[model samples]
Target: MRRDELEGAVREALSHQVAVARPLSADPAGQAIRRAKRIRRRRTGAGLALAAVATVLVSTGMAQLGGDPGRQGKPVVVIGDPNPSGRPIPSATVTAAAPTSETPVDVLAGATLIGVSGGRLELPGVGPAERAHLLPSGGWLVVGAPTTAGRSLWVAQHDGLVQVLLAGAGSIVVAPDGRQVAWRDGTGLLVAGVVGTQLIGPVRTPVPGKAEPVRFIGDNVLVRLDPDGPGHTLWRPGVGELTAGSDRSTLNVYGALPDGRLVGQVSTDDPAKTCLAVLDPKRDLKPVLTGCGPELSPDGAGAVSGDGRWLLVNGWVGKTSGSLLVDLRRLGQDLTAVPAGPPVSGEVAWRTESEATYVDGAGKLVQVNVDQVRTGKVAEPVSVPGVRPGDRPVLVTG
Candidate 1:
């Protein structure tokens, strides 16, 4: 046979054999395509998972380092129960007889004072109080001499509960919010709050002397004073100390305003006269009111109204002097005398912008209306019993 004819016959015979073979459902081309698609999907899923992990890691790093690390994860640490002894005190409710100028007053029964309306309550602890401050939350921060050897500082709640914060505390001051407290243990200044207690310093640092907490400059920062010197130190929890105020003569800081203005008495060169001054650390220390004598109160501390609009001065006028109410807005104005039958001793607290409450010499709680005194009119004094002559009364509002 011829070569071309034989090649054609072979090709035809091969085509016939391919058609007669068994058919396969799994085609090589289709299998290759599905395998490639599966590989592509796996790569895509892995890339997305890696991206998500990276995002989480970046966010966690920012939160750990960018903000205040000390306060980030810190929990509130409760020191003790406000009321240790489970016995509840009687709640007193006082209602006004009629609309009168007399401010509602209450006397301290033990360490608790229940107001006429029952809304104002102050539990200053059960023990005899050496020093006490009315908290903004209608509670009391009290320093008591519970034992013969040591002093106790406590935060007493309005619900007849008391929590002893420090046992051997010396000098202590509560913050404006009533949430934080700072006290002195020998030479060390310690601060405590819901977060916990932190020691600021011995204040003496390189030397040996005493230090005390003056007042809270801000919510988180406080001003500390060294009795031996005239300068003041600013203390923050995480941050170290910073110097505040000038190195002038030592000024006793009593109260502080929200704007960081300090209200206190400044010692003068003349021993006969001292002056009440409002100091701004950013400015020069100048006296706002001069020619002030000794304080009538035992602690020699004055009271500043909650609004920071008025100041109650307890100056000595022989032995019959009463506390003077001065308008903070009008610093040059004369002080209005709080009317009492006899000389008023102890501290006076502002019940309202125009009203003040104080304990008189006869151990009576007297409420004085400043507007009436300014107009030469005397509102009948509302006398409250149970408050002793030396009992320091502080006015509180709900």
Candidate 2:
């Protein structure tokens, strides 16, 4: 009975304490009321916060995988670039092949001109489409615009040589890779040191003191020295001055008359200084005619002289059908042609016109008849020790 009464007294005291917490006690009814209000305020704040979050998600168009309170009538996202019809997607890469084997390739990218007619190069990934050229011999030919090089000219020849410009007729051979190039300057001819962006020459035939045009020929740069004499010479970087090596070089000039006959502006009056002369780069004397002028040698025909002093022509032009024997000399009204000895080397590889290299196996150059290119053993044999150290000879044929 005592225990039960004590329990009842403890419960009554707790109830009394709770009632006084809001009122006068240190724990009063006033404090209890404040506590109750705080609890109610917390519950209300939490419910409002949840309601605000739900409202925000619905208004902002943000969504979760499952539909939420914010989900009204919005559609689900497909997650990729979508085609409503659901068509099959194809790949972007391309594979192409031409229908014909013979196609002229005029434009190219990332290409290298390995020879005169064709070249080798990497195909570009963009721009105009390019097709490879297949030769009759099953060899590959590439045609493209010139490319920048590591001190190399864009042109290469069939003989696997680079074209090097020079000053005179004598060619200046440049070493492979264009590190060194041979050149001539008047009497100064050398096959020695060269480098990137070096002075080729003063661009003068006679070093350009006169007002003459200077141009970069395949193997050399050309300029008229006296403009009157046979002095229009080519200039190269290491080479000082040189002329076209062939006997009919003057006629071979673009501005010259096709028949080796000059009717245009006369450069000089004195025949001694103005006459067509071929200078042996190693020798000091000048010869009458130096190279084979094809246009001037038409079936025993002769070309009129510019100065009206002589007739220039090939000595034995009518003898061979395709052979060219260049012999130019001064002829009086007698019409009797004077013949000179020792033939000049003129043929160059079209692929690499500037390199001073012959594709024949002959160590010593021999003159050929141009008429025989169709059949008469046209390809001459030339060999230059280490230059062509193969059993088969290097060829300088048509």
Candidate 3:
């Protein structure tokens, strides 16, 4: 055969091989491409759906963790002005008062004299005392039994007039700014302001196992231990239940700062061993103060200064139950303890950021400078009349 005939035969063979290797039908090729695209689309959709579900789950978990779901990732709104005009006036300067009488004032009596300045004595209204608190704005919150079956809650004004705020109340708590008040009656939690009182709660509320006290967390928000047990529930009125935290330890939260920091005690199985800790409720339950001992009162009863810089703690010093001033800035890292004189039966009042008032061991109302306390110097106890020996005084200042 000729060269041209051989080449023609080879070309025909190559064409036949190419045809055999090619796809059998255009329909099959189009179908394969379409099927690959559908698989890619399905995979993409599935991934997006999984991400969305995960986001929802995360949000739900955060809400259960005591975060305000509506305000998540946002700043909280704090009510009331920290500083107003006409504050820190000389007439309001309680530390300047001097005790004059050793006469025992029966605080349990309907009316009791709280303090004396110059020659004048400050006497608040009288009643069967249930509980008393000092308002941050400068006054007294006196709750007592007006009748055998009912209760009376009054705010003793700066002018010596007692304002009847509530009747048939069981518990009361003043707001951080002292502009509002909260009380528990037969119905539930009732908040009162210049506007008026409104009930916020389960009408037929179950009785708390212990005296469940109402505490203000924000201007319009408050927290109470779940009457059922150790956990806590936050209430924001119109906002409904905002956040909640389960009790992971035996720490009892006494008070919370405006920023959501908690001041409480961490109690061990042994009653004698307890420590006061400042905790961040929003974070894991670890305390900012690791050192726990007798320095912190077992009752965990302490007061934070309005500036949030100082903490006045009531605890036993040796055999005597006394009060100590702690600087919050150095908490957990260093212990800056300031002696608040001898222990009194009642609460200590802060007259200024650096000065506080308490009843001395002799039953005399005494005022001391916290800075002097830090220097290991005990200031002379200025005597105030009307407060008797063994009488517990609830100190309040603006």
Candidate 4:
């Protein structure tokens, strides 16, 4: 009942309250600050969005998140990339979900530009890519959207580190070995060595007419000049000289075979038709083989297999817009054709010597097997999850 007794009772009550009470959050202010930082980071990276409509892969019943369907994976951010904005580079590998029963069928192919993880397209950190070339080092040199100068060129490493290589760049090509890259940046054609992800010892040479490097064959680069004509040249990087072939005026070279022979479309008697011709460069570029493949597309939308044994071209197959597969081994033999559902966009990519893929009009990725087509069968179309029709023309490397 004394004053000291009353004080002791009050202190005991205060101790009990402190022991039982809890803070609203472990660190409410710190949490709020972290949330604000994340939002700002997203806003800063908004300009890097390549698609008009952002896409996210939704895991089907095959893969479940916390017992429910969910987005595939988190965005991977790599720091200290060459980006001036200091934005984290989103690694393509991170967005891949584990394979599911609904996963698209994958075929053996050359290295793809973007990671097709789990049979789905893992959109890279680069802009809307118009074309991509695979680097021998397991990376990609991506050609992005058009700008005032030209298209933007970016290098995406295998690790998903994206760096803007050059802006306003014209047609670009990576050497067969992936050791070098050449591009026309309006001023002239430039060839640069590629080490890891960096450009080294860039050498420039002025080229006349509208020149675009097409392919790399041995030590020479095949260049096409004036898209409308049969003007082509072979140039050696850093040599500063363009060599015109004896057949340069007549042959519209598409690409070279593994044996260094040139494959191109030669004029036929009918104005509407052209022969899928092969020119032996060793023999003064003379046409050794001349026979039009089945319905070779007028625009020549096709590609040759690495071995040069097969040729695939886009054309009509019984009134259906499709791709024709020809056996170069037996040029006069029966031709194999596969219908292209929707309209075929972008060029076809050889997944392997016998398998190839292309994005159709519907933004769906479709694969074709040479063996299956030879048997009079067609491969099924695989829908690229999360991709809408408008997200095309999706650039998958050839």
Candidate 5:
């Protein structure tokens, strides 16, 4: 909708609404006549003005539903259950996401958003679109709508003299710590990420002569199942192929366990089989757990499995697809569940374990609690303006 039309809608809605006014009759006859006239006149004028304001708001979808501008610009997108365990989330005046940092940027729950900062990015395949939120980490996030293209794919703009990613971005990531990002682009994988503005370089994960899927381990590293070589090649940032697995076909590199130990599996379908094992370049592979996949924390301090425990087969529904969270305290265990929502491809945000938030099935903002995890009761969804999507939701974690 155009800006003017939004203004008109707001005006129309406010025009006929009643206002809190002092009792009209509690006055002397002469004064009452004057007061009544003044009230009517004021109401008429106010109504018209409000209508104008409403029109602006509705057309542009810029609804300042709460606090001032500063608070409205809270930069972070998280997908998970709402922490209904206790305190209320701070009221925010959310806005549509934009290319710049100051503007009120918004994205639909289903849509993914990528922002790049620090420098410019050059995509050989596509051109940059309109102004959207870009991070300062020298990485640009591209919102790839989940179609065949993949759900809301985020890519770092180009960087370096011969840039590979996040180069078109304006803002840079303040602190990436040591995180690696990857996604499937057809058969090969594009891996480029950061540790707070530090470019981790991108690779066209070698698939030997016959291409296969590529997986990210951590840092600026990736594991490619060398078609020619015997097993998986453990690739690291700037230091290619640190180690290779014994059996080339089975080794699938997931990533480094926070303890600096590598974890992975031999892709399989049998539930009775253990899928997880330690891939230390030093020692031989050892079985640790199964029925769960390896995942690391945002800070790179830990790893988790989506399912803390193996599913009991007798009554178990088909294995859950979203993910399994493993308990760090126990070696061969996993978390019950991490809340089964669609996998949003872009930046994901999560505050605590129990309280999680994500854009729901209908593209409305949903806050889920542990109760929702047990019963699958999603909380009332909230809407952020300018964000428009119906299939997937993205958490903007800047």
Candidate 6:
């Protein structure tokens, strides 16, 4: 099957569809618009393999709804009762995980590229950066501070050379391994591999009207369509296929583990009732575990430790600000929520396997240890050398 023919078939399958917007109140990403009518289109199984390849050709239309290897090929787990517990789990006795060999990445102060450990990586041409991500190659991907003209992404080489990657780019996210990046552009979602200071093999794939890249699980980039909605699509760059998103309608994917399991909120039949579920993306988004509670919702900012053992999320516990620390090793069964000061920023960066740092309401960096969280203790907030009260820091970890 040729690329053009595959794309043409996809167009024919989608021609009858008309998109209508509806509002969803329980959207995890906050406000969101839902599709009122969906045209159920299907294609022959034989063409499924080719559909994945056609996605890389850079089309302006949606990918074919054929068999996505990432979703269709994996076995789905059937649980007799999805949620055995009818109520929210406020706390649990956590089992400690074996130490891992994963190396932790350093925290870089906002735009300035100042490392928390020490020293600064000066980006020559790039203006004050609002966001900085550590690349696997020991470089940095920074988003220039926004102005009346909008923001852009710039790459600073390990040797201190700087160059702009994309202009008017937002929702920019680097893969967990720091090899690939995906961001929203005027046309749609664009993804590319990073090698040193240059982007290799950039591919533009069409997505919904409003979308944001959530995180990467291996080569597949999870994207949330509808901007404010829970709707998501897993863009598989390795196979060049953009999946129809999770088949589960109520599941709102937030953070992902290194092994490709997704940690997110699952809404029940009742909108007010929601719980955390760990989903295996390869297994058709099957729920490996569920029923943590609404308090564990990431509320947009969530981070998984380098070893994929701990998941730290910022959210509300009752009326107070708090963070949920879940041990992924036990499939989210062992977890606890700790009261947090009003957050200076939503992001949380892990300093060690058991310790994570976040800016509190006082604009001071506060460290939270897993063991202390279990006993309801929080460390005193300390100030970072270069980060000022008004600065919002962006944290990345391997």
* Top of the candidates by TM-score: 4
Each prediction's TM-score against the native? Answer: 0.57, 0.24, 0.57, 0.67, 0.40, 0.65
Superior by lDDT: candidate 1 or candidate 4 = 4
lDDT by residue (1-398, candidate 1, tens digit) is 25574444335433331112122222222222223233221121111111111110110111111132232222112133222223232222222222232235433434544344332233423456644555543445665643644566655433333454455455566665555666554434556552111111222111125546666666544444566545455566545544444546435555555566766666667655556667765454444444343443333445677678767666555665556555666544553334332334445566676776766545556666766766656434444543445454443321
After TM-score superposition, what is the CA distance of residue 301 in candidate 3 from its true location, in Å? 3.0
lDDT digits (tens) for residues 1-398 of candidate 6: 56696556446433433223122222211110011012112211221122123132112333331233322222211001111122121111111211331112234444444433343332335555555666655556776676654466666544333455555555677776667778765435668766553444567676656666777767777777665545566777656646565554434665666676777776567655666677777766667787555364435666667667777766667876656666666655654455533443545667677777776555556677778866766466666555555555454344
Q: What would the per-residue lDDT of candidate 3 be over residues 1-398, giving only the tens digit for each residue?
A: 35585445335433331111222232221222223233221111111111111111110111111242322232211111111121221111122223553322212223453332222223333345545554433345666644644566655434333344444445566665555666554334545452111111211132333324456666544344544333444455554434444544434555555577876666556655766677665554346664454456544456676666777777666676667766767667665566676654444565667776665555456666777778887655555454455444444332
Q: In every candidate, how many clashes are there?
A: 4, 67, 8, 5, 86, 1
Cα deviation at 197, candidate 1, in Å, is 13
Which ten residues in a row are the worst by lDDT in model 3? 54-63
Candidate 2 on 179-235: residue-level lDDT in tens?
333433223333332221121212222333331333233344444443344444444
Measured by lDDT, the strongest candidate is: 4
Off by over 4 Å in 6: 1-107, 124-130, 144-150, 238-243, 246-254, 328-336, 340-346, 388-390
lDDT against the true structure, each candidate: 0.45, 0.26, 0.45, 0.54, 0.33, 0.53
Error of 1 at 228 (Å): 8.8
Model 4, position 59, has a per-residue lDDT of 14
| Stretches > 4 Å off in candidate 4 | 1-93, 96-98, 101-114, 119-125, 248-254, 282-284, 332-344, 393-398
Off by over 4 Å in 5: 1-139, 143-207, 210-216, 224-232, 240-244, 247-256, 262-286, 289-328, 331-348, 353-386, 389-392
- Off-target runs (Cα >4 Å) in candidate 1 are 1-107, 118-125, 131-141, 145-148, 156-161, 194-208, 220-234, 242-247, 254-259, 283-299, 316-320, 332-347, 377-383, 386-398
Clashing pairs in 1: 82-161, 82-162, 83-162, 94-116
RMSD of each: 27.3, 37.2, 29.5, 19.1, 20.6, 19.2
Residue 264 error, candidate 3, Å: 2.1
